[model samples]
Target chain A: MDKETTIYDIAKELSISPTTVSRGLNDHPAVNKKTRQRIYEAATLMGYRSNTFASSLRKQRTNTIGVIVPMLNSNFQSSVLAGMERVANEAGYNLIISQSLETVQKEIANAKTMFDNRVDGLLVSIAYDTENVDHFEPFFSRGIPLLFYDRVPEHKKCTSIVIDNIQAAYKATAHLIEQGCRNLVHISGSLKVNLYQERLKGFKYALMDNNISFSDACVISTNLSVEAGISAAQQILQMDPMPDGIFVSNDTCAVSCLKTLSQAGISIPNDVAIVGFNNDPITRIVEPNLTSINYPGEEMGEMAVRSLINYLDGASDVAITNTITLRSELVVRASSTRKGEAS
Target chain B: MDKETTIYDIAKELSISPTTVSRGLNDHPAVNKKTRQRIYEAATLMGYRSNTFASSLRKQRTNTIGVIVPMLNSNFQSSVLAGMERVANEAGYNLIISQSLETVQKEIANAKTMFDNRVDGLLVSIAYDTENVDHFEPFFSRGIPLLFYDRVPEHKKCTSIVIDNIQAAYKATAHLIEQGCRNLVHISGSLKVNLYQERLKGFKYALMDNNISFSDACVISTNLSVEAGISAAQQILQMDPMPDGIFVSNDTCAVSCLKTLSQAGISIPNDVAIVGFNNDPITRIVEPNLTSINYPGEEMGEMAVRSLINYLDGASDVAITNTITLRSELVVRASSTRKGEAS
Candidate 1:
């Protein structure tokens, strides 16, 4: 019920014209410093705030970026969001965030909302069932800068920021081989996602490089959830000959599988080596200290925003850069380190 | 750059007046259903998204809520955000979120930005060192419908959604005492936060009720991080007679302490019993599953947004209802179960 303070009110209070008040507030060279100080003091006393909405309409920029993630509760996504918030806030841009909840329908709806809201730019990690990029066609046709991170689509117009998942997964698998694990199993997510598909490629490539036979049975496609880990462990328990090495797509699932396997009387590293992606805190907390790929979630998030902001500000043209890949490395731990193993 | 498609473009494309297109788009009864369909088709063809800025200026509403949390990377905060997002999306409201990074200065700056952006309402979980509510006074004065969850401030105008921390802590401490623990230690966070202060009170009250002498020496104030847990364990080890029961304020710290103590040759439940708050997933993964309080972070988040939105929509008067307490319970596990104890 209270009215918003406007330049007109400040002008009336200071006995100056509204034009003079606006110029003074905007720090125009036409306005003297002494008058500007008096105007600022009056404006503060009256609780005057510049109307961002009206100004945004005139400038055709909202100074806000929209971020769409598959889900927000995951450790990796949250870390990425933290990084985005840090960078965006420092750049004086607000982030309007939404979750697709891993559903393509919801992803489409979220995209529509973000587009209608007129965000200056958008950063997205597509949903699990996002079969196509048709939903984002409006952004592309309108020439609104769009960037994808982590789970990206193969779009020539949009730049993608991601870790080299194929390389990361290869390192994880190769480390298991070095630990004397011959019979290997890879716990993968939905291969429909490019990242998961690339990881699967990495797994097969590693097996081929090591002269190990590759079969479809060696890869178990799962949602990569905690419960999925337990279920995967049960499935492994029923295998003709249990796997000597396991590489999971994520830390949560890997840790869960390790615990379930340990509970089932399987010894870690000695009998089976395990490697997980994402160097989450739980990797260290889990017994034997899980060997994991340091995914650099925060850095990826920072880079995505920085690239998009730079492109928007014309400081850099991210459009020409197809993909920005951050470095990822395997962190050797007891989980994948066997003593007296074959060279 | 491509220009935005306006109602005029749709009207011109459809060979109709702009007024007819606008009314059809708004679904005015004066416009026939056939005309509305034609307007929708033309709008889609032209990519005519509703100008939210200009419309919001007329309605004095942005349909966006601002949320400020201490940090975005924490498990609990992420879960809370997921809940908020689900509810807000269903209600057709957007969430512009930011993190204070546990600094009051950042919190103040975030609030100012939110105010300038004209979010319809605000939900806040205060930072570690936020001692006063002065930063949020503008929202309070503007009748903008502000609510706080978890680490809330003591404000009359704002309704807070939180679990009863004192009761939850009392339950945890009482569970430890019932397991035949006389020497008890409580690891807490900064007392500046009301939630932490209340937990300390509960710990002391539980000791008093059990006829055990309470001492300030029995309490350890920490940042409650994983590293802090290790430091607390070292501090406990140095005590002349180590405590028999330990209740940590959160799962991350408690699990860390439990692991450190176990590595130091202390047998859990037999040598010392431990209880943690916020039954995080790590509680189950720890060697001996940790006993913890189920804090219901998602429920808290949902409740906070529901209350704020209800008040904003005139469905409820949240201001009259000062505090909304959700249920929190002790989840007993292997960490605190002493076999054949005195009880």
Candidate 2:
């Protein structure tokens, strides 16, 4: 690395007092405009960096926001991050991002790193097996604003931004039932997550409301992935009476199931109906299209960042808002429209 | 906001000398273990931050890296960032990321933000239409390590880690020609980027090597979006004699062309062979599957971060290795296999 240009270098090169150069660089009004301009030009030529760390130290604010997510490659997470980058950039805050890779240990490590970095705020979406957030105690104790979005856990001192997963799932399941599905199956992600747990509750509630008795056997709890979807389809085929309908927590998995079933000569919406969550672009391209829950990932991200920045700028109070729920709707496409009827 | 706890707070709470408490916090040799423990407990109870920022100001190293990318929502870029976060976290450095959204103006703002933040190093993938890199002059002049990957520009002082786009495009085009494609059309992104420009050059070279005359009209320069692919397909249909082969720069656009052509009753491979760059998951999910260039996004990401960190650690000189190119291959699938060859 090149040696950093010090105030002494700027002072010597510009033939100005070191104190004057320092004051000019710090934007002290006592420095004359012409002298300040000369100092600034010399500083630019020497590639002098502003001493922000010193100011941040004095103010006890890092001017940085930490973001932790389950993984970085998913479409939902990516869209959310794009929105976050926009809001955080506009608010003059840098976003330090880390991925948990869906592991609790990694999440803990990310939390520690973020805390160690002295971030002014933190935004998190918990990983699959993250049962507790003991690692974030430092941030909480320091009174740094902590916010959670998407796969969030219920905790005090943490404001959460999420859509009503239960209602969305309930509407999806009810739509499948309305499509004349006699026996239905719900392919879900790990039940440890609040989103999946609430979604499962909604699925059961929908089934019960339609005079259908639900059992633990009907729920296939797995890591919602493409391979898992194929395996779920194989499991459905082996049943004594094949499931007439299937609803997966995510579109990637659901599209895999649709493909696998189609390859097995089971016609979509004719012999079986399917509904997926997260209205990802894959839903539109998949054969027969897919019915899914239109998750507002970008909107949720925008809200989360906007709220965090607003609180930081003293424009709003985030303490009073414990949880902010966004709107989500079921997008019924051809995949679940069995019997040529609206579901 | 809660008031930040200071050394005075810990001293007052523990009824100890402020100097002694500060010494304990700084791990001074004079401070005994028992006294240090007492200071630590009081500090924790009072929510005392370590004030590393102050220490860093004196040391002149912030231990932070800045990263700039064209877009954050793409699968390839996300995988790259995931790999980067892993390496940076283990190295005890934080990554402050920003997206240019493929605009030069945003790229300039992101650079200014990174500069103002006083990051230790920078990693960038140049945005579309970013013909000049005046925005990065501060980092360049300061001798800070500026590493580029993927859509990088030609710069002497910077190290670029990228796959050979020309070679990859050559392989893809050759595969189509081998499958009995006489006339070919290369659907590519803007020529403003070196990557797309190289790919286009390779396509023309492949045509020349295959004894087919390359025409200016055969090359369709576009944004390489799904919408662009639809227009490309429409243009192809209007041709006097529709091209017998098509190779698109990215998968989303390739899939779009495939869908549009299929809807127009043009059978893939049999009527017009199609190939795509970037073997994204969508390639496998698309009907008949897409033959594509197997670009190693994860490996490229890992290499980029590893090189940058190595340069920072003094293990390697980036100037000595101006450009590091990774390998890319053609993954032949049903989309370009007219002879019924399996992938």
Candidate 3:
């Protein structure tokens, strides 16, 4: 391997003092613009790296933000990541990203790695089964900024960004009821997650307000995968009375369920109205155009990054803010619109 | 901020030599398992973080890999990232990720950031408008391993992992021809990319082999966006004799085109049989389940990271191999299956 070029090497080549070269490289106003440009060209030509390692040690900042997501491939998470990358990049910070794969153990491991790496701040959307925020205690002790988005923990010290899942679900369930759906079922994810638990609450509240009875049999707890949706549809088929309305937690599962039920000779809206969460592109591609909650995934991501950066820059104290709630809306489509209902 | 704990602090706390503390932290065999466990517990109690900054400077390895993609929110790119993350995480490396936003300028800026961060290795999927590989010249000059996947550049010095786009396109087009289609149109992305250019070649070759003359008018260049697909469908509707078969470059655009055509009173697989590439989940959700080429995005990502890591680990020389091609298969479904045709 070749030896790395240092500012001292550029100083010698440019016949300038090492301090002048360092100042020029750092763009300290002490050096003129022309001299800085000359120093930059020399550095580029000599393959001189700016030595982020040394600078990070001196400044006690890595200029890197750590992001731990539940999964990387999902539509909502990916959109959130895109928004985060845009904000972090524009702020001259790099993102160190990892997925927990929906396990608390992996999330703990990922959090430890981010801490060991000395990331300036962290943005996390925790795993599905994470019951506690104890793993992040080290960050709080060190006074590192930790902000959670989407699936967040109920921690007073840590700030969070999220949409009102309960309101979104209530709107979806109400729309289905207004479409003349009598017996309704809610296909939910793990109840351990607060997001899904709140959604279940919304479902029950909507039913109670509409003079309909809610039962444990009406809720199906699933991982909310495509296969889970197919199985849930099979379960729906075996019901004696049958469900006239269905509110699924996500679009991926809902689309698969819709397809399976349609193949089984179920007429959409006319026989069974359906509503899904997360207005993913799949919602539109699916037949009948699924009604869903626009969860504002990208906006949540952007807000998370912006808040963490602001706290880090001392422009704002996110710790005092506790939580930031973004707006979410229910988009009604043909899937939940019966013959007499407006889409 | 409080001062960071050091090995000396741990040594003093445990009544041991700093050298012994370092060996225990590094898990050297000289330190017994019991002593190592004690050292770990003490280090944890004192909130001692391993100084990766100083260690990286001494070893010239950051234990980090940089990844640059055209966009972060796309289904294909996210899947690739998930695969990469799985492999890299198991290998004990962090990923610094960024998006180029489909511009050469942004790609260049991302490459420079990765370089400045002194990443041990880099994985890139070039932007749509990137015409040259000059931005990566710094990595090549420094002898740092750089690998490309999916939308790769034609550079001899860099290794790339990709699917055979030409063969995949040939299979898709040939399937449409076998379904008894005479007239055909190909939806394509920017020809500047080698991947799209090769697909165009395969589309032309398939027509030539089927005794169907190819013409410039048969190709509609697009960004492969949903809006572009709708506009392309409008253009197709205005043709003198509308195309009987269509092969789109990606599922996102193809599914949109299919929906637009379906809404315009055109029957799928009867008026115009359609085939798309990158068998994304959306393909299954679309009406008349889209026939597509199953591009292995996750596998491609895994291969790219594995190859680069292998090269970095001195286990194998990826540069000697140049390119690794993964297999892609054509999945025939209702969208491209005409009456009496086996799907």
Candidate 4:
């Protein structure tokens, strides 16, 4: 925060004129490379910081990007943020991040703030239930590059980065069937989200493909929180014949369900098998390591920032690209294996 | 990213000079409130934004604060961020956050970037291995307010927000002792950080208070990651008689150790009462809920930002107030109670 060292300081240190130091630093043909190197060295030694505002006034670029995420507390979201941070930092861009706390109102406020700050581009992973995107009109009107990652909305002008949730879900459900589960249940998030809707579709399709009845009653919709997991397990316990297999949309809920069932004297993989999504670290620490879909959260984050920067630098036109899908794999563990099958 | 609207547009629409419009926006005593509200409404309609740089030319203050953390992927750090964001946003100040990724080199680079960005105030939670504070000379020289939270360094000019880690650890260790744990083992992170160091001291004091001689062999230093928990369990299993009690610095590692020990046929509570820190949601979902310290991460964040803003606005001086300690408590649960004493 101290006063930025000016070219005069550099010249004074080197016994030269301010003009020569500025020209040298700017790489003018008139100044030799040796002189430029000397000027740069002196500037660095004096802790001289380039006047970003003066340069921004002339070049109209800040070399900074803005990012808005729902929250940074979750393992998946944090992985994504770490990925974005690495790519942005390596590319000589700083990331200014804010969380919306899963509210549309807060998301709008964050968008307005980001706009007022004059960020060159934006990367966003939207809140839980964002019904309208009119708040982003200013960015669209100005043609500023905008990209979305996980929890994306259906927007044509904006590019999206995500994994194929449907395919991952299908593989997870099919793994349950391969373990000899005839009756299975899928615990889904709110149907409003495209991720959950697609995952539910995959679950139903897998059941149908195996000549099993895909009943609407088999799917349980909840917030997918740990408490929701406990409630889901309670509901399962009350059934005439408990579910033989369970696939949850997230790990937090699955862990809670597994704990509750174990407490009620239910045998895992023998009487019931379980699968969860996101491959969160908790999946491995549970009593029976949970089988789950390995979401590429970090990779998705890295890709989102990399793509946005590429578009900003004219290395690529991401707007023409609709969706970038990353790979997701099914990780089989003890929770969902009845036959002790190798994965 | 678009051309910013200025007071000139508002003045042109209202048939007034640009100077009068600007003065009205600044709430000049000469301008009536009705005229000021008119200008504000017109500015809003015209999509006008206040230029902090132009205003700072007269006021010498920027309505922006910078935050640097070691990483964004931890439960504690994210909770702190949520609290900071709520306070900073409510005060109409923007926060530019960056991660150090637990390296001193990255910390220095992040500090330089924050300085270059002309942040009005800075909040830092120093990296694990930052041996020197020279990187912060720029902020210190200019009388900029610098505050530290959580993993703070021993700096005179900076104010820090933290909990009594020693007391929290003492309490946790005392609880384990009360549960009849004689030979106790403390699983700790590297002793580089003050929190870990203080917690180790408290653990030693608890053992001494209980007439148990502290042995260096009972302490295991680790990265405190989930992988560390697995390896630590292997080491513990090789002990002469295996410690009767285990206390871990973090819940993630504690839960992993519990699972690994259980797999090795060691029953929790009955065999080894376990205690962990940071009452994360995982504590409840584990077979026997983990006993942990409920550290006030959100409150700590809010307090740090609030104090920084207070210092910036001349409402408080961080130089005089060196440290602010928040409350922390041990929440006893099933994991550390074999004889129902915790109840």
Candidate 1 wrong stretches, greater than 4 Å = A29-35, A340-343, B340-343
Q: Write the per-residue lDDT of candidate 4 for residues B205-266, one digit (tens) a residue.
A: 99999899998998999988989999999999999888999999999899889888988999
Q: Which ranking of candidates, highest TM-score first?
A: 3, 1, 4, 2
Candidate 2 at residue B233, lDDT?
95
Best by lDDT: 3
Q: What's the true lDDT of residue B313 in model 1?
A: 90
lDDT of 2 by residue, A131-228 (tens): 98887887777668899999888788778999998899999999988888879999999988999999999999999999999999899998989999
lDDT of 2 by residue, B1-343 (tens): 5677889988888888999999999899899999999998887676676766776677767788899999998988988888888878788788899999999999999998899788888999999979877879998877778889998887667788899998889888988888899989999899889999999989988999989998889989999888999999999999979999999999999999999999999998799999999888888888879999888887887787788788888899877998999998889999899987755
Tell me the spans in candidate 3 whose CA falls farther than 4 Å from its real position. A339-343, B339-343
lDDT of 3 at A141: 85
> Can you tell me which runs of candidate 2 are displaced by over 4 Å?
A1-43, A339-343, B1-50
Q: Candidate 3's residue-wise lDDT over B1-79, tens digit each? A: 6778899999999999999999999999999999999999999888888887788888889999999999999999999
Give the per-residue Cα lDDT of candidate 2 at A320: 92
Q: Could you list the CA RMSD of all candidates, in the order they appear?
A: 2.0, 3.1, 1.5, 2.8
Cα error, residue B73 of model 4, in Å, equals: 1.4
Per-prediction DockQ, in order? 0.86, 0.62, 0.84, 0.52
Give the backbone clash total of model 3.
0
Scored by CA lDDT, what does every candidate get? 0.92, 0.88, 0.92, 0.87
Candidate ranking under DockQ, highest first, comes to 1, 3, 2, 4
For candidate 2, the per-residue lDDT at A59 reads 81
Candidate 4's DockQ = 0.52
Candidate 4's TM-score: 0.93
In candidate 1, list every pair of residues with a backbone clash. none
